[model samples]
Target: MEEIRPDENTKPLTWKQYLVIASLLFGLFFGAGNLIFPVHLGQLAGAKWLAATAGFLVTAVLLPLLAVLAISVSHAKGIYDIGRPLGRKFALAFMVLIHLTLGPLFATPRTASISFSVGLQPVLPAKLAQPCLLVFSAIFFILAFIISYQETTILDSVGRVLNPIFLLLLFVVFLLAAAKPMGAAHQQTVTAAYHNMAFFNGFLQGYNTMDALAGLAFGYTIVSAVKQLGKTSAKSNAKVTASAGVIATGAIGLIYIALIWLGATTLKHFKPSAEGGTAFNQIVTYYLGDFGHALLATLVTLTCLTTAVGLLAAFAQDFHRSFSKISYHTWLAIMTFASFVTANFGLDTIIAWSTPMLMFLYPIAIVLIVLSIAKTAFAGDPVVYFWAIGLTMIPALLDMLASFPPVISQSPWAHFIKELQVRLLPLAAIGLDWVIPAAVGIAAGLLVHFYRKRPKQ
Candidate 1:
């Protein structure tokens, strides 16, 4: 393996290479959650779409962009490097948890299930839905495994072809929706959750997308891709990576806005559903009728397949690097097989199982990204990371408890803790109970850091 040196002289990537890498990154991040969440948000937010969309974009777009930039600028090898300031043990644990969450645990299985339910379920006959889902998921994971099995060609295969086709099909749906216009954007009745604090609701909703986490996970892969494009030096890699991020940013921002607008306008014609997949299917069917099913099925399948490939490849590569005894091929096979089995649990169950974990992990991920980007201000002190993450964990744990299903939530201890959190923690009702504690931790950590380093009196 040729090592990428910090000082190696390297040429910058061409605009074409940048576009390909950017497309690949975009495809990786824009999986099941990305497609469903925004459209559902637009429907729920209704008249408040602008403010709500802004909130969604903050976490969904801005934070993920910062995450990628942090990785590039720091020249970190992977997510483990980002968490190194915490401790070696902590870094390894965090990286493993992140990989699991983003891989076979939740996201990888979701790609197949979401596509099957939303895309194929509507088109297939009633009796065939079950067996078809089994067949579809098997095929989906097999294809993903095949694509990911060859690590080097992922960018060329996914970026250069599949992603563009996905975009074109998506454009057809969006363009026709705009041209036809589905009744005016009406200020429809929103759910109780969205009626008040819609912006915050939107912010929390964005957490489900998990793109920021994916950004961190995908950082090393993007860097490798950049190196494959012949940018070996740290500076060249960072520059190319940042440029690719910009292109992805533009692409994602435009798609989100379009999807949100589509949802908002179509609300007058169609009632909103709890599942974005259902709403999306209805919207497509309304415009293109039965023919739209084929278009949507193709788009959804490709979108999900590309994302699963990226994730499986990234996860396998990281784990293989960490534990050299386990070969990359073995890890890839394990991930694909696990994802295939989990996909059989279906979309709803996966979402239910994953939500609690995501609620717990998201706040920590956000704090880490912020700390990484601002590490210089604290002189890269480990104490800062320790304090910030430790304090943030308190409320993050509580947030997870709050999101627990009835079995857990109905417990006496859970009820007591829930009441305590709501009573004592600021913003607990909106799922942001960690904000104040994190701020306090940062301030406290900075004070200690500066005091310890002060000149002798």
Candidate 2:
């Protein structure tokens, strides 16, 4: 290990040590949502599985990798520090946005719903399913609250327990899927555009996982693990971050590939459906019969339960740290109650409602990831950060308004947006209302840079 800064806060670990940390982080990020979504995408993608996988990997895997890199490079203590270039207000707002996205508003509750559907529903009677869900969520969240109350060694212990369990369970399922193929995949009927478009949809869907944000938040924990093992220099930290990212991505990527392939094979036997989770369950039942259901139930419950506990703990700790008046216990109680309410909305409803939010948040996150990785060019240019962030916010805001089609159709502002859509080339190209604005901001920042640098004489 390299001799680095000796700050009490910085601990040292080796490259191998870092890889273990990264794998643990990866397990934390890979939950029931990760398992379910790709299967759904593959089923709909049909012959376009390759395209969909490529798309899914972008947001699902790559952007998250970039986020990890961003934290590694910036040495940010939190998301707010990374966004500090834009100013304190912006950084705070950005942090709040990320926490809310990953916290009770969406991801936390999702952990419960997916866990229930995959784990408990198999044994519950059809008539009793709704009531079962209600009871299960209550019990699940209570356990989640207890686990999340503090930072401890339990996280590592749980990682060791569940990580292999998830891998082995999925490996068995995938092996069986391959041994007895789900009949045959449908003929590739999707047009090239649909293939191309699936990538973007997958990219967008990736936002729902919020791993990109989690990457930013979780990077430091990995860093600390490395430091404890006696490797704390910037270079070693980078190596650790990269290695961990590769291991984590490789592990989850394999899982994702297998699930998506299974779903693709399922297309031959199952019809298209809106709810990916339900569709996934149906396929599991078909192939493995009753045993399959039991296995899937246990797998998802463990995945979802662990994730819920991790998230709730993260949110409560961070929120209490950020604002001190509220007691940690109180915050946990409030967060648990809120997440319980949201969980009732169910998986399909959660997915439906989150699209607009994802659409809005994705671009800004991408730009930040890009900027973070390509920091040299924009070095010391606060103006660039401010301008780019401001530009990205416009589309994000509009996306929220236009997220639901029916809502957009009935809104009085629909005609105005329609008119703007026709005039905006970038929006037309990718439904990105902010492309033109981002370009303009980049140009403006460069102009400002040159203007200030131009021979101050």
Candidate 3:
């Protein structure tokens, strides 16, 4: 065993240590949403699965890997530090919004909903469905709260226990899927929405995993776990963190491909489902029958439990730091309660409502992570941060409105705003209208940076 001293610079973590952190990272990010969304994308993309899968990997896997690197390379302890160049008030607000989205409001609650909808809903009678969901979510959040009450156990709980079981269960499905595919995906008909722009829409679809946001939030947990392993220096931590992230996201990427492929193949047997949960259920039930449902229920519940713990811990840690008036346990309880309430809204409603929020937040998050990773090249200029983020916000908001369901989006005022967004912004139809504005802001900010630093000649 290697001695790991704290406070001094240390060597890179050994392979064993690296695997531990990777396991923890994979488990933290690989909950129910990860399973549901990719499977759903496969159904939608159909014959277009390959291209859509490629784009899904970019956002779901690559961006998340970059998000963790952004935290490590910048020496940011949390999301707030990543956005600190923009000033205190701005950074604080950014942190709050992220915590809320990834916390009680959306992602945390989603853990329970995904578990319920996919694992259990298919087996219950329709009349009992709604009430069963309420009971399930309550049990789910209570377990998460108990597990999260002891943050010190996260590494052991997730990495050693939960993750291995998840991998084992998932491998069974993958093995069966690969050994006997239902039908040729390429032969399947591509859905209308995917006929033209499957790749880009798939890119957007990855937003539901929320792993990019999770990456940023989970930095503290990842770093803390590494420190517990004795890689103490900032540089050492950064290198180890990046290394573990690669290993973890690599595993996730492989699973995502398999899941999407599974969904694509299932089109031969099952019709399309509204939320991915239905598709996931169909695929699993086809392979394992009633026994598969039980297995899936166990799998998702454990996966979601670990994810809930991670989110609750991160939320409590960040909130406690910002608002010291409340203690960590208190914050944990508050978030757990809130997530329980939201989870009862049911999976479909949660997915529907979360679309616009994800669209709003993802663009800015992508820009922030990119800029933070490149902070050294630009001298960590505040002007660059302000310009890039400020300009991106407007289009991101428009992206949100544009993603709303027709009921809201078709209204006169909403229609007019969307039209302006489409007319004024490039890639508006693709939900990437923020890209050009973000680029322009980056350029404008760089001009200011160069002007200020030009050697007083």
Candidate 4:
């Protein structure tokens, strides 16, 4: 095999090439957790599934596309570049946090846990769930590690083979759900949390799919994939990046709607379950029975494995490049092990803990993306980034603190912050308290930047 070199090719990509990249992005986004989130949201939102899905699409699909475009347009090779204007220390810290959240700490492990929990564990004995989880996760991560061990092969594995099979199986589920309806979605009872605030709750629900975080983390993977096709010039790469992102997110958006409808209608035969895995399992069994179990096992494994490998490959590549002394394989091993350990904590537990972190990181990630895309307007000014990020962090941190489990969040300091947030934050009622502060920071930064640059008479 010969080495592949990227050229300064600025021409438009053929439709075939465009489809391939779109498929790759779609595979990366529509993974294990992705399957469950919107379905689960449907169960929660019930009658308001459409409104809820709209909010989910904003973060789950739209924000992620923006994140990829941010990388391409800003010419950022990775998260480090995206945050470089914030200063080296902040940039490094931000990169590590982003990687950890999107890697072993949450998203990567969720791939394994959700796959096992959904596909197989329900049939096993209660006592067996823990032991089986251990066995399953070990095998899952090992397979993921082996696949991701060779980075170049990830595109082929995900885009060509695994993603297509999972989609086929998913199509069967969707078709059956539509062909024979469980019940009218509009007649289902909306849960209390989503009764009045379905959209906002659904917006926050999108946080669970973790696509937005994965978007920032997958920056190098998408850019590298595009370059492999010889589109290396900034303008060309940005165009392709934005286009592929749209194609991919468009597919994901449709899937989310179908799944949400599935969830809402299932309420006829089933009460809203604690998680999407349960709703999905009930629907599959109703439609396909024991055969569905085998099918789901394969479907879950394929979807989760592809995503796991992609995350591991991206994680190892970025970490190895950043910390050269620690070999790529070593970093891969470290994350793989950590993720396996975390997976055994169970799917619900992982999600419960994940929310707080997602709450904190989502705001920061959004702000960073916005700054990167609008960098030229402010001339790539660090002051703008610093103010925007710093102010965003205060509210983001409060949200994180309040989102934690009652044992922690109910404490004096945490409660104080949450109370203060409710009292003072403009959008606090809707769980978007970060918006006002972030905008104010941007306005403040631009004002200071121009003031400092004005004639010093």
Ranking, TM-score, top scorer first: 4, 3, 1, 2
Tens digits of per-residue lDDT for model 2 on 1-457?
Answer: 1234644435554466656777666765687788778887777677777767777887788778778777666666778777877888878877887788787788888888888777676567888877877888899887777776654557567667876876776777777888898755556345345566876665555666777778877666766665666655566666666777788887777777777777777766777667567777887788778888887787778777777777777777788888889977788888899999888877777777767667777778777766666666757478877777788778766666666556663577865775575565465435566767777776787678768878856
Stretches of candidate 3 off by over 4 Å are 1-12, 150-155, 227-235
lDDT scores in order = 0.81, 0.73, 0.85, 0.85
Give all TM-scores, in the order shown.
0.90, 0.90, 0.93, 0.94
Of candidate 1, the 10-residue stretch with the lowest lDDT total is 1-10
Over all chains combined, what TM-score does candidate 3 have?
Answer: 0.93
TM-score (C-alpha) between model 1 and the true structure: 0.90
Question: lDDT, candidate 1, residue 288?
Answer: 76
lDDT of 1 by residue, 135-171 (tens): 9999888888888886657545555566567677679
Worst ten in a row by lDDT for model 2: 1-10
Better candidate number, 2 or 4, judged by lDDT: 4
In model 3, the number of clashes is 0
Relative to the unseen true structure, what is the C-alpha lDDT of residue 308 in candidate 4, on a scale of 0 to 100? 83
Q: In candidate 3, list every pair of residues with a backbone clash.
A: none
